[model samples]
Target: MRFQNLMFLAGASALALSNVANASDLTAAEAVQEARRAAAERTAATEGQEIVVTATRSAQPLADAPATMSVVTGTELRRRPVQDLAEALENEPGIVINGIGMTRRGISIRGMSNEHLLTLIDGRRINDALANMAHADFDLGWVPSVAIERIEVVRGPLSALYGSEALAGVVNVITRRPSERLEASGLGLLGLRDGKGGDTGQLSALIGGSITPSLGVVAWGEYRHRRRTQSPLSPRESELEAREALSGSIIGWWEPAQGHRIEIGQAAIDDDRARDTVTTGARPVYYEYQDHITRAQTHGSYTGSVGWGELQARAYRSVLERVNERDQNQTPTQPTKATDTVFDGRLTVNVFAGNRLTVGGEHRHETLRDSTVNTAGKADVNHNALFVQDEWALRDGVSLTLGSRFDHHPAYGWQTSPRAYLVVEPIEGLKLRGGVGKAFKAPSLKQLSLGYITVAAGGRFIITGNPDLEPETNTAYELGGTYYGRSWNLGATLFQNDLDGLVQTNCVEFCGVRGRERRAYVNVDEARVRGIEVSGQVTPLPALSLSASYTYVEPRDRSKDRELAERPNHSANVKLAWQVADATEFNVRGRYTGKQTIYQADVPVRLDDYNLWSVDVSHDLTRQLTLKLGVDNLFKKRLAESSALYSFAEPGRVFFAGMGANF
Candidate 1:
């Protein structure tokens, strides 16, 4: 579809959804507001901590939560020069930017791969259909920057609450809520590099307010563009792909009567990216590749106060359409589509004194359409799950949580995940927490189909699917503690994850054939990952604050008795922020990444370590206007220029300026 048509359709749908008056109940909104109010009132009482909902699917103080969690507020995001979700989260502890095939990046927590991490928006999973495609980062660009309120990250397996895809952890992006009063905000940014290519620009706007005493609406939009960078040694081939992205969302809420609330939301994303390539062989060839992807989602939920406690139900559908084309030999365009539909319901109530219980069930259906699936060009799968969680207050300042989930899949019979967590407060300012959990990820539809085949490496290799594959599973354990002081806080966690039945491709046909190599998917790997994370924050003066975090991970392939690839052993982040004046703020940040080992064409390659620094300044010119300036990669470090084994480009020494308006 054309950009104009896509935007028009998305805008029209958002407008229509915003005008919806009668939908579900307002229980969720009311609960969020109430939680915020309570958190504000407790800001200075005893322990100063924020309230989080992702830990237990309900509002609770961070200090008392039984899980290892982190929160990045919206205010902190606006202070940095972040163009994407990965950039915004690079500073957090236990996070690494893992490169997928060549250019795509995904989040890796602890020592786990990106495939093990599950991402969600407002507690609903964002379908990851593009995961099967090599070098695709389509899932990270769905949410607009202006619509985000906060992000909650859990650093361990959460399969006890969520079903599949929560094998490693979860990241939930929460959007802003509608207000009773009129509110609006806008931001514009541009960046320029010292070299020939690699520039960036972005624009975003958001507005939200009440249309009636019982109704409210919020809408937002964003546009981003980036130019591809050129390799200094090889100017004919681009190191990065140029991209243009447009995204928007509209959400409406209604309170038909007291103690009842309903919400409806519509969101869309349109992404276009392309690159140029040149190949040298017996005959020189030039090629141009393009990928145009569009995604749309619709979700509705109802929440209300029930006789027992509270009841909530929700349903949503997500659809992704893509058109991919290459200009070598005038190849025809390849069109693929994927859709995910889910229905979920849950009830929360007090089971007895000092105990709270939650019970929920979910049904999910996924469909994929591609030319490689079969002659019919379609494949599908269905899943059903039931889960229950109970929180018991063993005594004052002590809590224990036990939960489990049972999932049934057509291809795979059944899988059960269980978790046990304990939180203890031994002193006035110290808390200790620990947990153990089991998680699993079902094979993708393409992986489970017998007729699936894909050609890669310029058609030199072919991979086929297997129907006798087993689901990959993980067992994890963690222990952590935190200390809160008047002017400082410290936390540390030790975790280990054991994985079995990992799926990989093996030689199935033409094993010795160089040009006609064939492989089929199979489960043939066992691995273990163990890591430790430590972080601390201190305020030496009223205007100055400093924080730092460090992580050390060890990942090994037990089946091969060797260290895994692409995982760094050590990484750290440090930041210093100062309020120079009443209306001005200055910040300095630094990051260190250790050396890594990767295999290249059956040969082991070692990549060198690197360091990066950044400086930022923001000044409030007026009550409603702000100006910002920043510099990234202050020393101009490029991986391609430093390491012979690395094959990616880094646009170093870039300057950026931006402005924002709020009312």
Candidate 2:
């Protein structure tokens, strides 16, 4: 044994000497390329490399991809946050979740804020818009963790490839495809709040199998019900409303020949929410409210390998419907509905040297059957876009990416977005990257053609939209570097974004409802959004792993001389996991959300900073079944403690138990 060990060491030394000898007369990029090759040899002996597609619309190793990106695999997700995709991404750099209300959440990427962050499923857009001008929220929780194979996140303007709405970045949820062999899985979880009205439960299942030698199918279903949670201010009434949601999807795949594939899929969601007397304390005047949202989508695609390259043609039709009802003093029910339809297609070519060129187009038609109380009448708009991108590998260790897009909205006219990116590996394991890009968001028809004016609190204030609005645009750039060590990884980015023609309602005078100011939609000249993001991970021991990230953002509303609403200047997250045994593990996660500015009783208020911690453990009962137990907000800190930025009640220290299995 001793002799064998000596021989191995001598061989390793000789290889190291050869690399050192070759390091001379080598450019930094060349040296780094050699190091990457060496790393491939070392790790290839243990695990397969990770391949990502969203960064450049092509499959490539994450280490070789020339972009600022992060990936959350199914395994890592099981040990991280459990609530939703937004929470799962909170631990990553350049992402933040801003909550407007208990069930209302929006994703902010690199401080661009709101709908600027575009979301996609299997490369198709998921339309998330409502006539409600006050809320631009997107439900990241709609996707159950069980069905997600992995989530690819790219931080920076991607409008050049994805078109309008990617003014900030992009997140693509990649679902697990049908297996060549039979497979099945299920999950059941029981969760509850600490006090009255805080209870939740969920169940999910999925199955996939080959139907014939050339065909396969996969399907998934999930149902979740959560009760209204009580608020600290009104211990007797619910501050956050309760809701129930049901969602599912099915897909069929046909591989009639080698390197040729076709797919068809359909997905739907039904969600219902209410704020009746049962949860809210109200007088005889029945101030009752109910909301129902339904979404349906069907898509198909054909991908084939052709001479000199591969060709992919895809198309998907998605529809979103929303209904809102209100009643007072047993009055008649007043209902408002909004619906939107989206169509998208794309094609890609492997030009040469593994480089790629892609082109795509999309169209969205939105109609408001009955406008909400905030606006007026039936309205509709048609939006269209065309985009192109080039992922050119200039050399072995250096690469450049160029992209551009043109968007034409019937109401907003034609506009363009363009971007450029460069990457260089100066040494093995170290990558330096930077990019400058432009992105935009066209004004929705509801925003441009609203004929009704909002008189809040029975005429205390008024807000209206203008039809002559233009598209909101952004110019951004980022510089970052990442180092991949044998057992650790670290990265940092410095980014800045300048926004123009921001479309939002602003108070003419004292815009606050109580301030007796009227709000109107107008293009605010410009605003500067800038920030720094840093992230790192380390595996000090085979049994233990640690990951953490921090973001420092400064989102200034240059038009109003104030920081953006509900956005904190500093935020961070940390996660630690330890394997106790072959089938057992424990995890601890903590998050820090810094102070944010808001309005309480129509007065400017600064919320107090807060830290939350959670812990969980998972143990395999058998090779096919696993048990999970965890508690969120273990310290029991909640909104009632400090109403500074309180929009929703925190689920105080709740215990949850669940089980998952595979067959």
Q: Which candidate wins on TM-score? A: 1
lDDT per residue (tens digit) for residues 111-205 in model 2: 76757788888777777563343443434655677788889988888888787788888898899875668888876666666887656666677
- For model 1, name the residue pairs that clash: 24-262, 25-261, 25-262, 26-260, 26-261, 26-262
Best by lDDT: 1
If scored against the real structure, what TM-score would every candidate get? Answer: 0.91, 0.86
Model 1 C-alpha lDDT versus the unseen true structure = 0.79
State how far residue 579 of model 2 sits from its true place (Å): 1.9
**Could you give candidate 1's per-residue lDDT for residues 499-592 as a string of tens digits?**
9988888888898565588998899889999989998877665566778899999989899887788888899999887767656678898988
Q: Which stretches of candidate 1 lie over 4 Å from their true place?
A: 1-48, 279-284, 306-308, 330-333
lDDT of each: 0.79, 0.71
